[model samples]
Target: MGARELTIVLLSAPTDCVDDDRTEQSLGLAYIASTLQAHGYSVEVIELTGLRSSELATALHRIPAVDVYGLTCYSTNYHSVRQIVTHLRSHHPGAYLCLGGPHPTALPTATLEDLQIDSVVVGDGELAFLSIVDALKRGRRILGAVGAIAPNDLDDLPFPNRHLVDQKTFTRTLNHCRTLSLISSRGCRHRCLHCNSVVMGGARKRVKFRSTGNIISEIRELKKMGYGALRFSDDNFADNPDLANLLSAIAKEDILYRVFSRLEQLEPATVQRLADSGCKLISVGLESLNPKNLRFLGKAGMLHCLKNLEHTERHGITVRASFMVGLPYDTDASIQHFFEKASRLPFTEYAIYALLPYPGTPLWENPERYGYEIVDADFTHYVQMGVGRQTAFVLKHTDPETGFTFHPADVLRWHCLAHDLFSSKRHMSNSQVG
Candidate 1:
């Protein structure tokens, strides 16, 4: 059969959510699907979200039989992907199966063995995946896996195929307007121990940005599609050196958006520019108020967080501050002190998460070097929330100078305490505004 005659399915494993309300599809899988379609190949993008394992087979049964299956895997969804591949192999033995994403990239050989798949693609999968399709079309069987080469120019790639999923039905919202996610960059400049961005971004420790013209063109396309708001999915949207020009371009387009930042980049002028560009919100990772904890995580100090909140407040933009609860040297006393100081901040929303040393991250590879000991290595418990069953695995203090560490129960308690504190604060603030 010609390559165009073969059916290709790019399946995305269900995302982990606090609730089953996710409507947006995986942008990464969409890119691969779009790439395949661009090459005049038949491609179908299937995204599964918030479905239990028992429901997976039923969902798979609904999909038409395809010649190729490519599944996206992450640590949180590893087991689900395994179940999916098992079912696929049993049902369609002749199909070509492949796995890719952060989890598989971290342990490609093990993933291939565990899932019993044909091959795995590590790192950026756009070009590598297209190459795999080309090879298969030439009737070559791939055995183990191939390392993906990062694209030097992100602009050369086609925009994610949003048509594969219902973009208008996406439930993500900002300022009461439906928001769709978009990425203008790849990689990060920071080397936070708890983050795996550097691992997935390959050996490069620097950020790569799409040209301002390319990004604006995509925004215009989204706007024409009736999307009023966008969520910039970059590691740190403000990290782009051409941010000023990009912001100016976005302002001319007259669209609403939100972005994640480290707060250190949010100077008074930058914050004002962001506000002027219709930026309604900024999410900052204010990991901790203690300088020692900040240093441990390789994050900016509390001063940055305070300054970020001050500038955003002045510019009329909301700040959603996220904090980590169970870091090295975090004791009950120190946590309470953080609560006291954080309560006085002007952030509009708060989220408290536990520290998880994900596989392939600096912390997971060398816990002792960072004054912590991994008590649990289960990938299922590597989530961010500290108050739920999906909370991060327990980490113990290994350094004598650290003084205190979070016990498993303490982690939950701290998360609950912070949640309640901030919940009440938000309520009171809303009341005063009303």
Candidate 2:
């Protein structure tokens, strides 16, 4: 078959949760789909989140026979992808199966061996995926890892294929406004031990920013599509050196948005400028409150985060503060201190999660050095919430200073408590806003 004559179905596997609101659109697959379509190939993007295995199977049966099936893999969705791959192999035995995304990118050889599938696309998928399609069309035997030649010019890539998804189903609703997600930059500036950014960016750490004009043009395109609000899905918004100019350009466009940034990135002046640019919310990862734990996680100190929270509050922008429980050095007192400090904070929203040592992260590679024992290496249990929230990974050492022995169940115990507190606080915050 010729490249243009081939049909490709790009899909994301089902997540543990059936909750639609919690899931975001798969922009990675959307970008890959767009890249494929631009080269004159027939492409279909499927969102399988919030579906049971049986339901997913039923949905897959509905899709017409295609030449290739590309599945986006992540640690949380590893098993789900396996289910889809199994069904495809049983039904469409002739189809070429491909896996991409973080999980496969991190462990391509394992994903290939464990799943017994055909080919894994590492790093960027656009150019590499095109190469895969072209090679397959030529009847070339492609196996193992398909090397990626990532686009150095972000402007050269096409906008994500948003048309494949239903806007109402895919877009996020924040503070009574419908918001769509977009990325203005690739990679992140920080080197947080648990972060997958560095791993996903390949060995050496780096950050790449799309030109301000390119980003503004995409925003205008989104606005024309009836989206009044947006969510910046960049790993770190403030990491861009031209942030001020970018914010100024977005201000003239008159669009409200939310962004994720390091706590240290927000200053009084930057907060004011963000508010002026119609920023309704700022999401900061205040991973830990304890200085010792902060140092271990390679995060900024608590003082900076607190100051940033105050600045956002002063600017009337809601701040969603996310915290991680069960760090390497965490103790009963330290965990309590985290919640106690969180209760007194000025942020409008709270998100609490257990620390999952995702593959390709420094923490995952050297868990023993950080006082953790990998009791469960199963990718399904690697998820932070829902189905497999409780897993085998546990703390192995007692805090020498506190003489507190950490139990296996303490991680889930602390996470549940923090989650309860977060839920109650969110309810109260919503009640007050209402």
Candidate 3:
């Protein structure tokens, strides 16, 4: 098999148009491709965002015969992955099919039950992907094996093969600068109940960073290629203390960028440093304002987060705060309180999504306990737009008193509408300022 030329194809599922306006490339799959290339495999990474299931089938039919096919998916994309697997089995029966990323890692047994997926690469796919390719070449067993790879060892992995991504598609979808999504680390240190990162990667919270020199070098290369800004896709940028140093180093090189952070992690000094370092925007996960809801969601540092919102805005960085509604304890009054608080905050952009219970999260593991009733089994509906659990609500009829009731879908839709309105307002304000 080593003597023969191998054509490996990596596929990302189509994005739901209702989710958001921003387009994101499959940076995770890109990392997998990079790893395979380092281990001597020829690979092609494809984005299925704009393609229908049938289109994907047709495209798979036209591609040159490949030795291996790798796919990435989240809970919202499981159905698409299943459909692709079925098509691949019917058309390219000889091609080895492997599944990775959040959904597969969370539901490995269920995924294997399909029989279309030859193997499931659990946790980080970098080392496992390379090992599978190598083993396949040697006619070794590679299915149903768990790769207990550590996140701290991420520095050993090669940078993502950006050349495989469609540059025009990325530019058009993101609708911003000519940018590349970069991951400086893996695994979140905080325990967000609804997040699957800890469940898949483990709770030890291992973090990795590209060396300061390495990051700067990559930025320089992108700058030479006429790229404008970078989208740092790390789960929590401020989780690492050296982030300031990294920002300083990039600033020294005059590199422009954007990044995501947990609101609680921001400090005035750090916010100022980030702005000074050419950061045009910062996204913060402001999941909820209700203290009980926040506690239920396992969010730490609620007060710090509120303060950080003000601090970041004062520093002149565009703050994009993401909020969630329709949790188990959410009430109409509580949600209204959230909206009022959000209006007063300095966040220039707002992303409001319904509480989605994905397969692997703690919430999904024990939904009944959280007063949530599972409604949809289809993975496509698992997108933030789909209503998951019928949340039991507790409301406050007056500001001084708290009351209780239940109406899940309505609560979810209200939050979605609020998000849309805020987003539209933010965009208009930005345009006006420009």
Candidate 4:
């Protein structure tokens, strides 16, 4: 048989952290792999989402000889990506290695220069990746990266290949396995000071969307394969203009799923439609309870989320929300107010994270302006967990004027406190409302 041109790709992170085994599947890799396969190149997606630290090097070695290696990662995981890329290069000296995703897109030059990386893709990787492969096949001498162009007509792109996830290694929700993640749109309309969406693209957001027909086709295929749900991973799920039609189609099928949404966008009619359409959970960003902090995070006020939460609960929709512990707008009092008020909200599930000054965000660019000192400058300390292991680097912050310091440990304590406050349901499994 003739030699086949194969490319190995990954959607991964360092497996050093605890709970890494239960991480979610990388939908991004599936999309890119499908693109490469559509172009007639053999593709293999090597996911490290739930593997041991020692398994990464061995896994790369075992893959059949391939022409290129591709990876997508967050800034926190880039440290381990470096180690794997080194292993890939050492094993296959001629293979072209490239990096993409939030971290590489934001810092392409540095990411390429710091390691044995051959190139980096700065934006949406579907076409950019195929282009890179063509260039590599032609054997053309290349520079560092190819900039991004947001695909305006999403339906034109091929469906993401879920076969790459033929094995189940990622986290499950409501007893479902990696039930296909669908990105209905790209870029966000809001310009939250902390969000990196604008930096990845431009402030214009370009908000492109897929047609309802296209999404329905994939949902049908999933249901036929015994998959019962879909996770809509859109940055702004509600903003899609075709949402009503999309929901209608989803209802036609018996699919149960969830999404990230703006609580403010939900009116009575929309929430009612979602409930009837088999909506199981909605994960909203409840950044803070303070009106001032809410506005700072690019929200109008707290009333919208509060009102919407009540509306969702009445419809039997479970709400899972998240709050940031240490926004620059967060004073000690405001942080306390967040936890205190959160326990009273309609949501039963919650997550708490210390603020991250990731590369492309305004907070990361100008920490002092936000009243944060960033006592730790290393990017490796950027995960929701930390580097080396979970909770390794305590991100220190100062009030600047009051000399008050916030330790990373304090963030953990508040999370524990929040959980304890909700111990009745989470710890005890008592779902009865007294």
Candidate 5:
């Protein structure tokens, strides 16, 4: 097949309440585009916010016929993917449609089964995507079954084509001077029953970390570009000892950054090193206080992890603690216990989210066991809006030996309102004290 001019339009599906204001382009797509372009294929990534379903169809109709159409899907935009695929199949029947990212990786069979989608790239799509484009150019049939799926080897993947995304969109969402998203590694070691990473990356867990030299090079490049703050998006940033070494290296470079850490792994010395390394914030997942509830969610260390928040705070690094309200083991008393414990902690900011059982997660596999009913399968509802049966409230018949119940959404709402009221009262009390 001679060099083919392929018009690849990348679209980020919309989220629930979040408007189309800034369509965050997936860094994965940018990597794939860069690889494909290196292999001599024409590609263009466009954020699909302003275009309506029909308007998108009209726009596609006007463009020169595309060889392949690639669409990126997250858990929140699965439905939008279906809609776009359906429309594209009807309007532009000849163009090949491909889906990638967390959603497609998690539900490859479903994506392939859907008549509209031609193929789904499972993991580390750079090589797989290039292969698919090559196959298409050679007039070979592309099948959806997992092909060329490999572990995320950071060294192999090209630096993300940040130039593809609109600079204005990024500036509005991210404080680039103080904030830049950096993916030092890929894949997670811990399998939280409710997390999408477990489903997408698979059970064995293939993790690849960028070499310290490569990471420092990128940091230096970003620093030269005038980015002040760095945010590492690794699922478990502090899991490896080498992470400490990485921090030490960053400190040598005088770079400041923020990272998410599992509470269990954090040690006082490590916390001090993190602080000395110019670490400004540490986000810890203090999902719940109940040991039984924590075990059920596959969290190994409950108490020690929760205690690390204090250590992080004491080290002069702000702790952004996250907690989940509804778990199968939660009751009214447990909810109160969570609040009391959280209020005692020196968290600079707290984010509370109701348990959302995304499909393909262990929780979704046995919703009844978790006391969660399928409120809706639509991916938009998967964000944080839809309600599910509190796992803590209902007893499992099969597991009569053990049972639990909790109303996640209700408790979360109460927490939000309580925080507001408590803050107001605190302010009044301070004024009276003055």
Candidate 6:
């Protein structure tokens, strides 16, 4: 029998609480699978987004023969990944298993020591994964390896294989419009404390962009694939010379979309161009209103962000102001100040979040410097919402407060208060629009 038919399974831990919930295919996994396909490997994508735990093990067992199994996960799904990987190791003893993505990339040694995963891909999985597969194909031992970032030539990577997963059943839906996710660039080296970008990208604080032609080509492809809009998943799309060219080209296309970008990059001219280019909304990550916290995140002053928000709003683009709590030295006064500013801002929507120190972030590595102690080292509790096994608990706390005994609970409470105030404002605004 000529060269044995190589088979691989790519799994993404389910994000949905309910089974049958669908979503766009995991871009990272799809991209890796595409690379493998180009190398003559048979691949299938198993997105565990909505499967119930009781059904998961059996379901995975039912898939076709697998010589290699690859899993992509974030911190929130650490336990689920363990469960899945453990099952595979126990049942498919001869198969090679690997893990990639933010969690494994940040803690490659810990990942391999866990004993469930045979190998870990540390950085971008495209090249690293190809290498691992080639090594395995040759029957060479390459365990305990770390994947590194792709070389600077981002343009050389193939576009994500959108066909690997069903587009109609599993796609991003916004107001009855079909949306596809695309990342025109990668690696924002911004020093946002809670960010895990450093581990996934690199420490150079440099960004690389896809060629403008390549970007528009993907957009055109998405359009041809029946996507009415594009959701860019870049951490923050910084303004560059190439962006204007891309936006100008996109203006001729028939699509609407939104993007997350830095406040500093949104100059008057850039905001105007974004609006004119069918940009429906711009998400500004106002991580905190506290000046120290702002500086900590390498963000400009709060006034600078506010001005950008105002400018974007005046240009007829919806401003989605996203805020986070649970930072070092956050006080009741600071949270209240944030609420006042957020309520008064002329924005379309607002969201509040708690800071969960992800594995590779400075915050997680050195919590003592921030004056909070890490009470738990379990990676599964890094989740931000809900109260299930997958939901992360707040395992860090401050020293006893003088009055309120401040802690993560207080941060959550303040976040709730802020959320309620803005939600009411949003409701009233919608009423007025009606």
Where in model 2 is the C-alpha error above 4 Å? 2-4, 387-404, 416-424, 427-434
Clashing pairs in 3: 395-403
State the displacement of the C-alpha of residue 117, model 1, in Å, after optimal TM-score superposition: 1.0
User: Model 3, stretches more than 4 Å misplaced?
Assistant: 1-3, 16-22, 172-176, 200-204, 385-405, 416-434
| Clash pairs, model 1 backbone | none
Q: Summarize candidate 2's per-residue lDDT along 294-328 as a digit string, tens digits.
A: 88878856555576788798898888777887776
lDDT of 1: 0.79
Model 5 ranges with Cα > 4 A deviation:
1-3, 19-24, 49-64, 171-178, 385-434
Q: Report lDDT (Cα) of residue 289, candidate 4.
A: 77
- Over the stretch 1-434, how does candidate 3's per-residue lDDT look in tens digits? 56577678998876443433225678788888888888777889878776654566666566556889888877766776777788788878888889888888888888889657778877888877888888878877477846645545556777777788766665321235566667777778776887877665644455566677777777776677677577787788777757778878877867567788887678788888888887777877777777777787888567455877777778777777767777656665667776776667777776666676777787677766665666665555655533222222221111123334355556656665555446434632232111
Candidate-wise lDDT, in order = 0.79, 0.77, 0.69, 0.70, 0.66, 0.73
Backbone clashes for every candidate come to 0, 0, 1, 0, 8, 6
- Candidate RMSDs in order: 2.9, 2.8, 4.3, 3.6, 5.2, 3.4
Q: Write the per-residue lDDT of candidate 6 for residues 44-123, one digit (tens) a residue.
A: 98777666667777776775558888999787677778888878888888888899988888888888898567789887
lDDT value for model 3 = 0.69
Q: State TM-scores per candidate.
A: 0.93, 0.92, 0.88, 0.89, 0.84, 0.91
Residue 221's lDDT within candidate 3 is 69
Q: Which is the winner by lDDT between candidate 2 and candidate 3?
A: 2
Candidates 2 and 5: which is better by TM-score? 2
Model 2 pairs whose backbones collide: none
Task: Give the backbone clash total of model 4.
Answer: 0
In candidate 4 the C-alpha lDDT for residue 160 amounts to 82
Best by TM-score: 1
